[model samples]
Target: MCNTVKVSPRKLDPEIRTALVDIAARLLAEHGAQALSTRKIAAEAGTSTMAVYTYFGSMSGLVRAMVHEGFARLERQFARVRQTDDPVADMLVLGHAYRHNAKANSHLYAVMFGGQSLAGFSLTEEDRQYGRYTLLTVVGCVTRCIEAGRFRTGDPLLIAHQMWIATHGLVNLELGGYLIDPVDADRCYDTLLSSLIVGVGDDTKASAASMRASRRRRRREVEAEPESVAHRS
Candidate 1:
């Protein structure tokens, strides 16, 4: 007869619970949703299978945890973006951070957005509220833009939602390997962001042109550096 060990959530440290979720997220990313199982997650986490049940109650519970984790990480990344007097520029910075976060955590991003990734698990209202709150960060930035007379006078939430859809589509495509050239994808993202800002009645063309000029100047400066000096530094 095989013996099974039961683990109680009360006995497990919070770090252990976080570890289990992290392991599960990596598994989901590397192997896809169908490959997720309590036994596999337990082995990877170096804990008993009961640890899953103890911490999350069931697979659905685990999925919910993943969703929450994804949003929490996204929130942290957005929070790190510094606010500036130029609200449009600040919003663009936040957009870049959003893409960076999604790319860094593609598996978690999938679990959060991919409808079929969770299989039998459905996101509860609370899980969705967590996601909404993350978007609200962007909405706040957009509101700032409007207040600064950068964006057109309108509902900030609607404008933010449109921007989110555009940015999310780009990130999803890149993560899905649809964009093979990262440089081209990045250029496209910048163009898309510039266009969105312009559509909102901002003078993003000058900003975009200035950015290109700056990049060119930086490249020239680097190229002008003596090979010996470059090697030494």
Candidate 2:
């Protein structure tokens, strides 16, 4: 009888786990979920195929982990946004941040929102609750707006949900390449946010006037940039 040598599994590393998830996310984005496999992910992550099983248990588990990590990243981005005296402005900033984060992680964003993006993995209730909690940050901002008398009296959660719907729609369209013109996309987003703010009971005239003033200031700044550079030259 011949004695067989069996090698033990490599020790699990948290760093390696994170790298795997990140690489998987990129793969899912670039190649879609159908292309995701232990071999491909391991190759990209520079780890053994067993590493994926060790960390996430299976391909479905890995997809679930990606969804969780995507929300965690969004939560971090939301946490970093600076709160201000103007709740509406703060909400606008948060909305912009949300879009920025989504765009930066478009592949992850696709997995997070597009249920069909992952082949066999469906998001569990816990996964969805985590997503909802992230939305609570927006709800908190809306609550502050209502309390500060900036937004008209209504359910803060409902208003926040409406805002999210509008924002998500715009971001989804832009990410899917439906919104072709960047300038037009930006204008459309700004207009939608302003309209949503106004619909929620903010003074329409004041909001419109503020938007106009903002546009004018941006125009002035754009006009001044070349002159300022020429002066330095």
Candidate 3:
């Protein structure tokens, strides 16, 4: 009788796991949920089907992890916005950061917010709360604005939700190509932000000034990007 050698499964590194998740997200974005499969993701990531099982347990788990990663990335970007004395301007920066994160990770964004694609995955309330935590930073900004008397006295959570509602609507429209011209889109976005700030009881002139400050802050960061990259290298 011949003794047969039994081979153990290969272990997955964190990088490989992340690669699988990214590949899965891209596949979903490019071809929709119907195109997502363990086999396809494995093939795309240059691994076997077992890699998917080893890393994520199942396709649903992979998708769930992908959604969480989407929120995690947004939170990272939000964290990067340095808080300023001017809460309104800081909040504007956070809004711009939100748009940046969504545009940068459109594949992950689709999976994060597209309910139909996640139909059978059954994301729990806790899973959604993971996404909501990113909004807490905005809530803090709103609270500061209220305390400073820059915004009307209101529930910070409600104000933050309204801000999210307005920003998300405009961003979705821009992403859907409804806002055709980039210049027009920027003008429209500035207008929406200004209107939202004014609606919260800030004067029109103050809102416009906050918008300008936010733009200046963003430009400084953009100009610093090359130096930051050099330091990293």
Candidate 4:
């Protein structure tokens, strides 16, 4: 008769937990988002599957963690551009930075922008606000150029979309190696951006639009007073 007892599970360190999550993120950045899973991530990190669950709720939660990580990396990349005091120059720098990041992290970029696994993951209100606000940072630069009589003002958001699509298209094409010509991809992107800057940076009517918006806000305020008084009655 031998005394046999079951051995308890190995204890996981906090450092190991962090490493597991980081490995999952790197996997997402190297391969595609689909390649990420609790089993695989834990296997890579040399941790038990239970440890993955203890740290993150599910695979979806892990993907969200990766998404959050990607945004931080993107913001950090854009933060490195030395724009000094010129908005036009700042935006040009940011546009280039966008391309650079997408190129460097193609897999992560696909996860962020492509309609794949991420399609199932709903973006939270914070995500929506972050995307909208970050886009505005560049749009505001364009608006500043317009206000300073540098660029023509139509709609900053619309113009920002143009820039966004332009960079996205180029990066997407380059990522898939779909460029028909043998020319350097980076050079082509630079040329495209330069053309857009010249094309859209000639309007200077933003100040007029701002005045109109201010007046509209004042009118709305005035209109609200009567409505509130009527409601009180």
Candidate 1, superposed: residue stretches over 4 Å from native: 1-10, 115-119, 180-183, 209-233
Which lDDT values do the candidates have, in the order given? 0.74, 0.74, 0.78, 0.60
lDDT of 4 at 22: 60
Q: Rank the candidates by lDDT, best first.
A: 3, 1, 2, 4
Estimate the overall C-alpha local distance difference test score of candidate 1.
Answer: 0.74
The predicted structure with the larger lDDT, 1 or 4, is 1
- Candidate number with greatest lDDT: 3
RMSD of 2: 9.6
Lowest summed lDDT across 10 adjacent residues in model 1 is found at 224-233
lDDT of 1 by residue, 1-233 (tens): 01223345568666667677777887887887766899888876666888899889988888888888888978877776666666676677777777877876676788886533474887667778888999898899889988988777999999999999999999988887888754598688778888888888787665575345434433333223334421210
Residue pairs in candidate 4 whose N, alpha carbon or C atoms collide under 3 angstroms:
151-201, 151-203, 152-202, 152-203, 152-204
Candidate 4's residue-wise lDDT over 8-83, tens digit each? 1255454554465467766766666666777776666655677666665666666565555556557766655544
Q: Candidate 3: which pairs clash?
A: none
Model 3's alpha-carbon lDDT is 0.78
Backbone clashes in candidate 2 total: 0
lDDT by residue for model 2 over 78-103, one digit each (tens)?
Answer: 76666766667677767777787787
